[model samples]
Target: MNKKVILSTVLFLSACGGSDSGDGISLNKVKSNDKAKCSNSRLDSCYYDINQLALNIMFRKNDTGVLNVTASVSGPKQDIYFTGSDVLEIHADGEVFLPTNNGADSLRYENIPDNAQIYEFFWYRNSQLVEYNSIDGITEPSVILSTSQHDGSNTITTDWLNNPDYTYQIHTPSLWCTNLNYESEMFSPSTGILDNQRPPYQATLQALYGKNIESLKVNYRSCDISVTLIAKNNQVNYRNKQKRLFIHHDNFSEHPLTLFESN
Candidate 1:
C-alpha cells in the first residue's frame, strides 16, 4: 500500500468510530432533521426528533443579527454531533448568509437564499466533511462539525489524565511518519504530500468542550519531531503549546518509532 494511504488508514482506524460494526448513527440525516426543525419553528427549540431519534439543539443570537444554531447527540461508542456558529441572518428580504470566520486572521461568506432551506450536514473521521446538503438558499457552516457513530450506548470515556481541568481528550495524531523524512534530511521541510511537495509530517487533532483545533504545524530536525497545537478560546485569544518528541531507530530496524509526551 502507498505510504500516505497506509498512514491515513492507520490514523483512521486509531481514532474513534471507524469500525465496521453496526454501532453508529447517521449524523447527516440527523443534521438534516435538525435544520428542518429550525426552519419549521418560529423560535429555536432545545431538542428535536429526526427519524425517531432525539437530538439536543441550541441556538444563540449573535451580534451580526444572525442566529447561531448548533445541534449535537451524545452517547457511548455512538454519538451524533453537529455545530455551526456562523451567522444565520434573515435579511430584510428574508435571505440568509452563513458568513464564516475563514481563519483567525480572515473571514469568508456563504450566502443562503430563502428558496432552499433544508440542509444535510455530516462530519466524518479526521474532521472531514463527508456529505452535506447544497440547498439553494441554505449556507453551510464555516467550521466542520464533529460526529461519531452511536451504538445505543450513551457513556463516553474521555481523556482526563493529561489535563484534569478538561474532561475530554483532543485526538490529534502527529503526521511525522507521513510528512517529514528525517532519515533523508536533517532539516525540517515546510510542506506535505498533499501540498505537492515532500510530505511534511501531519497529525489529526481533536479539541475538547466543542473547541475546534486550528493553526497546526510540525517542526522536524535531527531526528526530532515537534507538534504545535493551537485553539481559539471565546472567539478571541489563542491557547498555544507545543509537543516535542524524539524519533530514533537502529540501522537494521524496518519501522521507525517515536517517543513523545510519554506516548
Candidate 2:
C-alpha cells in the first residue's frame, strides 16, 4: 500500500476545534529566550518562526503508541527550521526525550513512555529564539476501535465511556475517484463538443471511469490507517495555543489501530 495517501494535517493560520479551556491542560506564554540570536535576518544562523509545530501521540490497542512531531517554517528554502542540532525535546514526567530527526521537516519518536500523563511540546522559533510550546496529553478511547467495510462505505464503532461527553473524529481516505470528481466532470458529454468533432459516448464513459476503471477489475487500493481521536470538553483556561501545535488532536500515529481496507 502507498504510505502517503492520508497525510495528517493540523492547524496553522488560526485556532479551531474549541477555545482554550485549561481543564487538565497547561500552557506558557510565548516568552523571551536568552539564547535567541539574530544579528541579521539574511544569515543562516538566524531562526524564523514556523507556520506550525505539531506533536501527535496515538496509544495503540495491543502495543506501544507512536509519536510524530513536525515543525513547519514558511520561507525561502535557504533558511532552516531550527538554528541548532537539537530538533525538539519533550518533557514527560521526570524524563526528557529528543525525538529522532533524519533531517526531514518532522521528527519521529516511537513508543510513548509509560506513566506519562502530561506532555510539553518544546521547540525553537524566531530571531529572539522565543520558545514555542503547547500542553497536550494522550486520550485513549473508552473502547478500542473496530471498523467494518461494506459496499465501499465504512462503519466505525467505538465506546467513548460516556459517549455524550465526547466526540470521535475519523481520518480516512475515500475512493480516489471521489477526489478527482472535478477532473472527471471535464470529460462529461455536457462539456460541449469540439469544433466539428463530437465526443463518442463510449470514449466519454471510458474517460470518466479513469482510476476506478482499475478498481472495477482489481478491487481498490488499500489506504493508510484510518485513525480516530476521542476527546472531551474542559472548562479550564489555558494559555492560548500558538503555532507550536494547532490540532485538538492529530489525524494519526505511526501505528495502526484501525484501517479502511480496499473494497
Candidate 3:
C-alpha cells in the first residue's frame, strides 16, 4: 500500500474516535466548570462593595422575651441570609431583600433565641457563598429607627423594634440623619445614648427625661451645629464633655425620636 494511503487511513481512524487523546472534549473539563466556592470574606467582597453599603437591622421582643430580627439593606449585588441556631432549633430566614431584585431587601425572623448575643448573616448567588458576619443580638432597651430627610425635614421613625423599646425623638431641625452606613448595632441600651450615628453627620442625641420624658437633644457635636428639637430643649451641648445621656433599662413606655444633625 502507498505510504499516503496508510497516513490517510490513520487520520480517518483517529477522526473516528481512534486517537489516544480521547474523543470529544474531556468530560472532566466540563465538569470542573462548576460554580466556585468562596470563603465568607471572599464572597462578600466579590458581590458587595463594603464601602457603599447601607444595612439596617431591627429586633423586636415577643412577650416571652425572645427577640425577632428584621433587616433592611441597600446596594447589595445578591441575596443574603440572617442565620442563627441553637441546639434545639435554627432561626434562618432567606430572601430578605425588601423588593427581591436590585433594590433593598428586608428580612424578618420571628422568635430569635436569646442564647446568642451576636447573630451571623450571609450573602450568596447561585448557591455560592459570598459574605457573612455576626451581629449583636437585641437585648432589652434596644433602640432601632430609620432616618430620612425630605425638603429640609428629617423624619426619624421606629423600625420593627419600637414597641415601647425606648422613649425618644430627633427634634433637631436642619440636620442630616442617616444610619451612618453601618451593618452592626446602632444604639447600645447599656450606655443610654445614640452611640452610632452613621457618618457625614457626627452629632449624637441624648434622650432627656424629668417626669414625663421631656426631649431628645444633641449632646455631642464635632462641628458648629446650631439646631434644636422641635417640641423642647432649646439649648445645645457642644464640647460640654457630657457623657451624652446614658440610660439603661429592662423596660420602657416611650419611643423617643432620634435626630441626626449636621452642619
Using all chains and alpha carbons, the TM-scores for the candidates as numbered come to 0.17, 0.42, 0.28
- Model 1 CA lDDT for position 257: 23
**Model 3: per-residue lDDT, tens digit, 92-192?**
33112221122224554444455554343433333322223343434354333333331222222334343332333332323222323422222321122
Instruction: Write model 1 residue lDDT over 108-177, tens digit each, in one string.
Output: 3343222333322222312322222121122211221212221122122211112222121122222332
Which residue runs does candidate 1 get wrong by more than 4 Å? 1-95, 98-226, 235-263
Note the clash tally of each candidate.
21, 4, 21
Candidate 3's C-alpha runs over 4 A off are 1-53, 62-64, 76-105, 142-263
User: Which model scores highest in lDDT?
Assistant: 2
User: Per-residue alpha-carbon lDDT of model 2 for 115-208, expressed as tens digits?
Assistant: 4655555443332223334444444333433333323323222222334433334322222221222221112222232222111111222342
Order the candidates by TM-score, highest first — what do you get? 2, 3, 1
lDDT (C-alpha) at residue 156 in model 2: 23
